[model samples]
Target chain A: MASWAPTVLASDTLIDANAVDYLIVGLYFAVVLGIGLMARRQVSDSVDFFLSGRSLPAWVTGLAFIAANLGAVEIMGMSASGAEFGLPTVHYFWVGAIPAMLFLGVVMMPFYYGSKVRSVPEFMYRRFGTGAHLVNSISFAVAQLLIAGINLYLLGTIIQALLGWPLLVALLVAAVVVLSYITLGGLSAAIYNEVLQFFVIVAALLPLTLIGLDRVGGWGGLTDKITEAAGDNPETAPAAQQLNSWPGNALSGFDSDLLSVVGIVFGLGFVLSFGYWTTNFVEVQRAMATDSISSARKTPIIGAFPKMFVPFITILPGMIAAVLVSEIADTKAGEQVAGGTGGTVTYNDSLLYLMRDLLPNGLLGVAIAGLLAAFMAGMAANISAFNTVFSYDLWQRYAVKDRDDDYYLKIGRLATVGATVIAVGTAYLATNFSNIMDYLQTLFGFFNAPLFATFILGMFWKRMTATAGWVGLVSGTLSAVAVAFLSEDAFGSLSLGVIPVGGQGAAFLAAGAAFVVDIVLSVVVSLVTRPKPVEELKGLVYSETPREDLVDADEASYPWYRRTLPLAGVALAMVVVLNVLF
Target chain B: MPTAPARATQRRHRAGALDIRNIIGGLLAAYGVILTLMGLLGDPETDKTGGVNANLWAGLAMLVVGLVFVAWAVLRPTYVPDGGAEDPSAD
Candidate 1:
């Protein structure tokens, strides 16, 4: 037996997913529900329920934001990508997703909050007026449903693979557990559970990676094994290209070129960053729920450091697993077992295969919890966003403004249950595609990108009329979506051949086209379009600083380095370095 | 009673049409444009028979679009938001 040292594991763990495992998972559920019940009392109004009375500190939102967004799909998808591509695939999350956030927090956040809108759909209201807000609200809610569907399916699939349970039952149960807390508490419950879930998920995974390493024979052994296998037939194995510096599929040339690297930087850095940060109600709600200006700015920025570390703790194992594929198929005592390629049976199938064969029972249980935490956190986050848009954007417009807090919170609960049903359905239906979760995230980018443009032009370009905002949003989104359906086949694996381009390429192309169109149409149309009144613009920029808080405002004034330009320079420098180093 | 202060304010206003953002945007647009342009310029690298011909067509189309953005941002009138109009903090 491989010695269980340097980290934690035991021989029995491979078969040990038992009642205790279920108990711990159940205990976690109870705690989340309890917190929801307690926090429910604090929310007495729609504003309080939806916005936490704008009182949550930045850290709460930050932790929750990362935790929720990190859910089962991200965990499963990244590991899937990691197992398939080896160590380099981390670029999608670390190099691509992380830098995009830094670009967003400094570049996009300032512009987004420059106007005092609460909900993202509300921003559409100010920029496009109420009619367009209705359109955006529906689209935004549907987009949230799309994301939640992916999370639900991923969670169900993980549970079924681990437990041998029915997928339909698993999906329904998963939805109920998440919706219970979200319905009871709203954002507060989701955030509270998230901060806790973050700890639980990490607590399990990091130890597993470390322990799995020694058993697999440390870093040196992993290297030797891979080399020995690949070396046996040097001609058969793919050579490391670009030192794995610019991550790309070994299958495609578009992945290897410096142009792809540039695409990763800009597609992630500008367009997707702006789009997700500004438009995605799921991640953005965390920033919006901050109680004060400092709180709003602080949460997203704090996530930066933690965000950088995840690929190592999560994706790195899958990389090593790629090296051990041929070995896993056979034992020290026995002959070959099942199919294997590049150490993975299938990109999506491999990680579970490793867990079932490689890990001990107790560690299996803990890993199972980590998966649960990821599932719960991710689903809860998406549902929270979905429920918010459904309740705030869609429901409230129909409901009277004067309705009691209880009724609205009740409606929110009802919406949570509805969203849960949709999510469960999504989970079941997700079987339609081979790797649908990864595909969903990239596709969501198409819809969200135009919303980012509206926020930007509204804030900085003062003459950008509300009418212009509507026209730009509609034109940009329709054209982008049209381009999406049109261009998918042409782009294939690495096709930048068509105008719209492929997934990452299209994200930027759509957003860039949207931004350019947004600017031009907004400007040209606004010349004929009516201008926003000065009084409205005043409220939009600076919240009337109460005299009592003058000291706070003065104290909170950020240092020079944190200013947008200088900080952007640092952000850019880091992006360049990451591209070079990775 | 609040009046404009004499302390220096950061230059929040951007004058150039292209900065950190558009550079990223421009690259994507250019990637599209280049594929299209290469087809038209008859460059071997981007040539895709029909694909290059299509990209060439797209490149000209996006070039027109890009030029529209270039013209709009540079020539479009700027407005000072309310505080921006009067508050020195905005200045």
Candidate 2:
């Protein structure tokens, strides 16, 4: 098991900020606050506050959709994985994200937007009655709060690393800043800030990548350096093997413990990626905020363009860090040093060390500010999602029925505050996890893996019954937990002939198992039970539903090349090219 | 469709130059300019990491993109439609 204790790097090597860095960071906060205050007038009702009045343009919503998922851990963790695993890590972007993003936009958006569900859980209630809704809402609320806590924990670590502030002080400062804007502006404010953060992160990290490449004599040089380092250490994997994107070579059979082609294709590409990009409210909420049906449908499609190139910024840094920092060493029992200052580095600190070593004062400040913006955007997405689910799905249905719009709006705002307080408590609890990213993936396995099966059956199959929905969800979650516990010795090995694959691979297998279990149970139970009537299932089930919005004949008369199909075609080709090239 | 006066009122409520996109674009452009200036005239001590002045180039790129967003917002502002009511079934 990885060590849970925080690594203490040499104090002398810590980041030293000049006046310019502080000024830039201060300016960023001021602008974010100003945007929030400016949006206050736009939010006069619950709909406006919760869903941006569903009037956002395509470009804005598109960028925010991807940005909402760009949590601090994604940036740091992907880079860390890059350093540890090498080229195979890029699968998280290409195979794991693009196809699923496209599926959400092209296949699912019509139902989600036309049916007009306020949240994903609301869709559950509409489709399967109260039982499914409660199951989805309660699980989703807890998940969002846990995700918010993770975001806070990461932000605190980054702030403490950069400014020498105490972790508690850092957490409090971030909470105050995020709450100020989010409570004031609501979803609109969060989305606007998310877009801004998208730009900031790209601007900051692109430069870092270019500089690192230049110093290393470009990509070819980087590969050579890593290879040379690996050659010198017999304990490490071969440099050529590390550089290759494919799972195994002639020398070693399916070498990586973290991934295999089978696992990648099924576990991540099909299951986890679809489960996340398709059903997760944090991402879908952004798409749902667009001004029109077409715009909402186009949101994730547009977002996929930038998403295809994100690996260059997020994962390339890890490759650079691997070449710059030393190799992994086990200094004591249950403690492994992955290499940096003080003769040890946790993989999580890879991005931190890169910033310290490469960036100067003015740029360092901008990068730090960008990182902070990412953290806040991530937190704000979860908080806003939590409030929406709580107010619409839980509170409106259960706590206070027949309330005015104003009353619900008040409840929504209060829920945001309450969620933040709960998140703060969870942040303290998160300290026990050995790796934040691993813990998060396990959480996804427990909730979203099965949730996707429920959605697929509910949306496409008209025969799926209400009883089947709740049963599938509960059984799927239990099976996932059981598999995970069995895989680990900590829970005593009850492995049912399934070999343990560590890290992402383990999460993938658990999720894949859950998906299979959920689908089977849903199919069996649904076959035996009475399905909802076809007339009532209109717009919810694809076969029974008529398209709500038809394209203009003038627009339809345009050539095939002018349509969205071409864009999707190009995206598919690019994914193929990337996988082959890498 | 709703009446003209109601539509006009809805449009009026949504109308503003201070749209979130405009605000974000303006802020990014302003910061990009600052970073560009710092890269050009500030201390040359950053060369220890590498000879490339990353701030200047990154700032220039951000400035151009930010201005494009500003232009997009100004030229094609979004207005709320008269019939843009939530689908009652959504609740």
lDDT per residue (tens digit) for residues A34-75 in model 1: 667656655556665666556565666777667877875557
What DockQ would you assign to candidate 2? Answer: 0.23
Query: For residues B1-91, could you state the per-residue lDDT of candidate 2 as single tens digits?
Result: 1121122233344544136556656666766787788779886445545777776876787788768877776577766545443533334
Worst ten in a row by lDDT for model 1 chain A: A3-12
**Model 1 residue A511 CA deviation in Å:** 5.2
lDDT of model 2, residue A462: 92
Q: How accurate is candidate 1 locally (lDDT)?
A: 0.57
TM-score versus the correct structure, for each prediction: 0.73, 0.90
Q: Distance (Å) between predicted and true CA of A333, model 2?
A: 16
Instruction: Please provide, for model 2 over A349-412, each residue's C-alpha lDDT reduced to its tens digit, 9 standing for 90 to 100.
Output: 7776777667766778778888899999999999999999999999999888998999999999
- Which residue pairs clash within candidate 2? A339-A345
Residue by residue across B1-90, what tens digits does model 1's lDDT show? Answer: 000000001112442111211221232243335435444554322111212233344345545654454455346523323221121111
